[model samples]
Target chain A: MHISLKPELLFNLGSFPVTNSILTSWIGTLLLIVIAIVVGGNFKRIPAGIQHVFEMVYEMFEGMATEVMGAAGKKFVPLLATLFLFIITSNWLGVLPGVGSLGIYETHAAAPAKDTHAAPAKDAQAKPAAKDAHAAPAAKDAHAAPAKDSHAKDDHGPVFVPLFRGANADLNTTFALAIIVMVIIHVMGIKSAGLSHHLAHFKNPLEIVSEFSKILSFGFRLFGNVFAGEVLLTAMASIFVIITGNNLLAYGALGGFIVFPFLMLEFFVGFIQAFVFAMLTLSFLSLFYKTENSEPHH
Target chain B: MLESLGINPVLMLAQAISFGLLYYVLNRFLFSQIRGALEERSAAVSKTLADKTEIEHRLQAFEQEQKAAQKKVAEEVQKMMLDAKDAAASTKAELVAKAKDAADAEFATAQKRIEQEKVAAEAEVSKHAKTLAQSIVQQLLSEKASDPQWQQEQIKASLESLKQSKS
Candidate 1:
């Protein structure tokens, strides 16, 4: 069976259907709550070992959120901090061998993102003519079998399972995140500018179409960035398989070791994406809704 | 494609709304407590530092006053000692003057007594000498009574003649 960034594994209960992306999101959510609970459980005047570390992290997140989101973000610190912690945790969690490499019901699947087949065959050029004759029939048979068994019930087809997976790798997840952020932006705008003024941004008689173009661009920018990152990471790991003749997990591991620098990039990208999402929403809201007495630049 | 796994937009929105609500509620309770505790702890520490500084300042002032008091006490003791010395000298001078006056009066009285004794003894001695001279003169008058008057007159005349001659 072909491997892919399968978000479906999380949504199923036995034969019942459930969304993997949602499942992963829920796991991320629970993980955040657990961390918050653990960190915040013991309250004392003098912070001790683990609490000290957690407090520093909390303070750092608070500072970043306030810096990016501004004074208005003071109230939203917990929410933004929670989101940042959860998303990063889920993404990093996908690097674990059991979570990223282990396939549900025992198969080599795209652990974090669905694997892609995009490597140019290096040896194909060595004996192309002779290899083509032998490979053509196999390819034809492969195409014909899917058509023959389209309605046949297969127990081992693409299905959902409950496990850890990359939350941003799934389009539904990123799309949902984007939409939520946008909605929050609108809500914030409305809260700041009031209904009429906030809506005025979209209701320009001369530039109504341009307003829509701007909105589309804003959403698409976030969508494209996260989507492309997931796709690229998937592609890089898949290439390791073609060159090294290993399973997706082995390739993923090898790719991780070789392309570790890229993973670091991914880490930073993930943080920026999260910050951008929150900041854009905040800015959009402030621009539309902020009172005249508020910061003039906003 | 993900619809097979129930990746519905409706469900996504529903999940987001529910989580957001949950987060908001939890934040109101949990986050508020944590944030409040941290703020309170910091405030307490600041208050403690302020209190410590205040006490220290008061203590410093008290110490300064104590040092001044000690200095004043030493000065007072020195003044008292000087006064005592002055009193002792004055008393000694008065005693010495009284003793010298008494000695001078005793010496004067003794000298006056001695002079009076000498005068009295001289008077007695003169009287005795006069009596002896009278006895001696009576004896001599017995022997030469006529000659005494005559000699006295003659001597007076002769002394007058001699005085006229000499004059």
Candidate 2:
């Protein structure tokens, strides 16, 4: 399987390449902007209708941030608020059944985040049941072009097929996020503490081995959660397809409705991840500086 | 990975960048403006309340002044009434004094007339008494002188005449 980083336009370099995912993202972004403008523009001393709704939302977010973070938390309100809105929006964008259904030059694609089989997975632990049900497809469609090599194998000339997908679906995206967050934590720690002092955390001869192990544990724990979540989603989607027939009449509609709640859950997960990443950085920085609330030696 | 996912990576990054930029711009222009306007409106309302309080204070002071002026006018009216009463009392007293003096003068004149009448009556009574005494004395003297000489002759004649007359 191969993943292409480069994408091509429909005709010329300046022309737009019509893909359903691209179209959906653009539509979502455009809608968000338009709503923001209509709500925010022509403001009155007394708020009414849409403006009032936005005000309430802002106040809610502001209150939550202050409650969780305290005085210091107020400074991070804007960042947290923006992150919350964007992540929820992106997660919900995929829930629409026809999000990437039609009006594209490319071959049939459904969700922008959908994987190889145009099917999503759910719960990796349920893979056994899902595999048994979906194994028939792989066996039957042996002649079908593999997703990774589809573009290359297409004999109808050299078609510059696009391969970039939603950043959240890929492990590279999650891993990169984890590493970036860790690096930011380290840099902040070092800045707060002298390099010598920061290094002293792991430099103690008595627990040097343990410190190295702890670092490994941290990385693995993060990777495990994110990877598992992606795989589980894939498997679940497959099982869903199998339970329903080739027609997939009932399950298809149910899946569309089911995605709404799952999207909400994913939105929550995204928020938790962002918060964990940020808080971890803050705590690490505090630790390096010996300013954090350390436990009593006794 | 694209084969396995049936999707692209470059498109994803592009999407992320687009979204991030859009958010940044909207936050800067729209949201912040609304927030600022709300703050300004709150401040203005508070300021207006303060101004209204000041005006009410001034009005209260004005009412107090008016009450004081009204009280002063009432006092002035009372003083005028007292003064008028005093003048009327003095004028009435003067009129009574004048009337008493005129009456005393009339009484004195009446007393003087009574004394004059008493003196005149006394003089007239004494004169009448003197005249009556003189008449009685003359009659008695005439009777005594005639009777002694001619007493015997005449007495006899007259006695005869007197007896005749008496009979």
Candidate 3:
């Protein structure tokens, strides 16, 4: 089973190396835009079919916004709804049969060398004490073996790079979403409470830390959930393949039995995570705006 | 760590731009229109409700007016009927009294005429009787010229009957 923390680079458009997750997100954006155009182009007083579904989603989010922010919440519906749609679509698209599985076998040499250099640093940062104590020799041994091999073979080994990955699985996309939401929240706060009042919240260092933590939590929570779901599905499918002794027919027949439930679980998790993300943003917005009323009641 | 996880600033910026575009499109097309439609529909509904209430009130007022008019008409009709009855009664009484007075006057005139007729007839009868008695007395006196004692006796009997009748 192959799992990568980073999305596979599909191709470059000029200097921008478009990754699989970016491509998937573009597809999601296109899908949403088309839906919006279709639904928005010919709105009926009496909604039907896809229009009805869209209205239902609009109403649901509007109701949630109202519940969170009262009348003012309505203004934030577009952002929150877009976030929900974009995230959920990306997540569900990630789990499609071909998304993670369908790929080209490119040699590792085609991959960026930067990823290799960054991996050890990331590992060291993630487990500094453990790496320094227990895993130091093991890490050296791993590097030594790769070094012992003819560098060309080790570097040019064929790697399966999927054409599409879940958009939220990429930290860039989630972080982008998080940053956008946080920035908007602050802007709204400043607009409503004045710059001085809005900035005054940072008087407490904990509050400053909280603001940064909010971004991290928002981004990682979504990325982790979607990425973990993908991993779980991959692991389950691989386990099925191993159990079937690499027999394609047996794998196909038994894979459903093992992986189908997890697929359903992934679907549930995708929707819940999307809802949670949007809800938390709404809650934070309400909380941030409520600072005006935060004075101690005498 | 971020680089290892492929958190490119350009990609992040691009995603944010994409999201911003989506928000703009959705806000412009879907949300604004729906909100407007909902507001318009609600306004129309409230207006229709207000109109309905106004119509109901007017209908109630019209009904009350109709009822009052009907009552007034009934009362007027009753009053007119009573007046007509009273007029008819007075007219009938006046007619009856006039009829009674005319009948009494005719009776009195007839009674006076009858009395005059009866007096005339009585006077004629008495004159005729007197004339017949005188004729019979003259004949008896002529037949009894030779009988002076019989004539004296007839005269005496007439005188005695006259005196007895007078008494």
Tens digits of per-residue lDDT for model 1 on A108-171?
2443233333112421232212212212222233334452221224434432222444565555
Question: What lDDT is reached at residue A3 by model 3?
Answer: 64
lDDT of 2 by residue, A1-298 (tens): 1222222222222433344335444565676677777766686678888778656655555565444444343434444444444434434543322221211123323323223333334212222233222222432232244433323344432222322223333333333334444554467557656698778766667566654444444434433443344334333444456454352434434544544455456556655654454444334433443323342111
The lDDT of each candidate is 0.55, 0.48, 0.75
TM-score of chain A of each: 0.64, 0.49, 0.81
Model 3 docking grade: medium
Complex DockQ per candidate:
0.10, 0.10, 0.52
Give the residue spans of candidate 1 off by over 4 A: A1-17, A37-54, A61-73, A94-165, A178-229, A243-256, A259-261, A275-298, B1-8, B25-29, B78-167
**DockQ metric, candidate 1:** 0.10
Candidate number of the best lDDT: 3
Candidate 2 stretches greater than 4 Å from native? A1-27, A48-53, A64-75, A100-167, A170-240, A248-298, B1-16, B41-167
Candidate 3 lDDT for residue B136: 92
Better of 2 and 3 by DockQ: 3
